[model samples]
Target: MSPQQKALVIPKKQGNFELSSRSIPSPGAGQLLVKIQSAALNPVDYKIRDAGLFVTHYPAVVGTDIAGIVEELGEGVVNFRKGDRVLAHGKFTNDFAGFQQYTLTDASFSAKIPSSESFDSAATVPLGLDTALVGLYGDQLGAGITPPWTESVGESKTPIVILGGSSSVGSYKLVKDYGATHFFDRNLSGKQLLAAISKVTDAPIELVYDAISLPETQSVAWELLANNGTLVLTLPASVKEDEGKGRKVIQTFASPHAPQNNELCQSSWAMVEKWLSEGTIRPNKYEVLPNGLEGVIGGLERMKLGQVSGTKLVAHPQETQ
Candidate 1:
């Protein structure tokens, strides 16, 4: 029998999550077997169980944010080795998901965790950061802006609106650190947001990122967009397109595994270690849950109830009993 590890699995579609034992999977070429130390919970984790949105198989494991140590390396994975501390963007596949004691990570999407960071903090970054990255720079799925890494990308004093609640960390810092000249309360209505934007700059609001992506928020974003502007949404777009205005609404799908995003994410992942070390990117504030994998159930429940706020909830998979 192969070595087994403790995992949190949903037995069937829209089923309850329970602790189970599963074989530790081996890494194939260009992959690394990670002994997961911390797995962060996202709203999508519960949404999957409640709505059966993504998984196609029974007894599925679903988690996307992970930080851990490399247990072994597969062929041609030269950047990592046994015992390296790393963080990765996990996928929907059972073997690659984060809700398990051990999982496999694609080498291109994994980055070494800095010495100054903890596993819990590192675990909060992958999904949120990648969503922002792909939305801002991905030509096919994003606003088609030039990435900051390239010399052609110049600093613009243009006013951009980001629709979401305030977060001192996470995506707030990501946008501000990247370059956001003004900030507005996400609670504002379309008219109020336009007034707020007017106070900041009149540079013609060319870009709006609706991080919330609710119907109400999407309406506000659509209202504020200029002709030929772009609106990036995290959820399915609720606002109708106005064809004559030449505006575009892109509902960003944040996954490194997607073929369209693979190369973009690879470039971003390569910069993650340096970004974390230099404080160019700040991980979300996180609270650690108890009882390891068992505590994830309650965490998901809290998320489903809209109880969690601002901070990310992380579980220690190694502490599973």
Candidate 2:
């Protein structure tokens, strides 16, 4: 390994970030040294870059969604070895390292790659897919509806509304494999939205996943809820308007530390891989920007301006090679 590699880093006291060379990391116990092949950009990537909210060190690595080959493994790391292709959502909570050419990740944080997908497409799945799985299919939210895992819910019909259907994460979740669950765009108008929803789910347009945070977009989901139906919102539920009908509102938060959530992420990734391989789910259209670490600022700027439409921006650290 080189003595140092460039990483996207931000200071604790300032909003500005830049790529800097630092010693390439070595895996600790139960950790893997990942030579990042690709790092997909997300909204939170810019948020942390601008706000500097999640930081543990003065000049900390940023961004979470990563896919790469394991260059080396630490003691007791049985699941991965040198040259194994893997993907991981870097931890944002404990100053989870990100955007670096190489970063140390726990074996639990990483997963083996699926053969059918490319490094770029697979990189975008971890964080968004993990969030969707935990929010929709986890025990707390999706208990009654059988997941794709068991054939019991064969051809199951449940209406799912993605409130912010246009965003990168929202787009990935809606199109992701979920047996026969119907999905609707909460942003669409009355008849058009209803028609779309009917095409996919057997549910009576009651259940929803509101990915949009805006009040105007969410109004339809609140009104459409069936009696005792559930609604999952990525934003806080407190701001949600009162639903006269008997309805349940869940605030969705995706984290790496939750045990049940850990399993949920794994399951969701596997499903995504299956769908990707079988052509059940179309890969999200992405604007591929093959840049080394120096391109972090430009990528975040495009993300902030909403310039990336229907396409997530991705960075390839391996481009430096």
Best by lDDT: 1
lDDT of each: 0.88, 0.68
lDDT of 2 by residue, 41-124 (tens): 877777766666556567777777778888888999886779988878787632246587887776776777678777788677
Question: Total clashes, candidate 2?
Answer: 3
Return the lDDT, model 1, position 48: 92
Residue-by-residue lDDT tens digits, candidate 1, 1-321: 999999999999999999999999999999999999999999889989999988999899999999999999999999998999999999999999999999999999999999999999999999988988898889889887788875566667776677774432226533556555566776778888888778767688899888878798888888899998999988888887788999988988879899989888998999999999998888888999999999999999997787887888999999999
* Candidate 1: segments with Cα more than 4 A from true spot: 165-179
Cα lDDT for residue 308, candidate 2: 74
Q: Which regions of candidate 2 fall more than 4 Å away from where they truly are?
A: 93-96, 140-145, 176-203, 241-244, 266-276, 279-282
Q: What is the lDDT of residue 311 in candidate 2?
A: 74
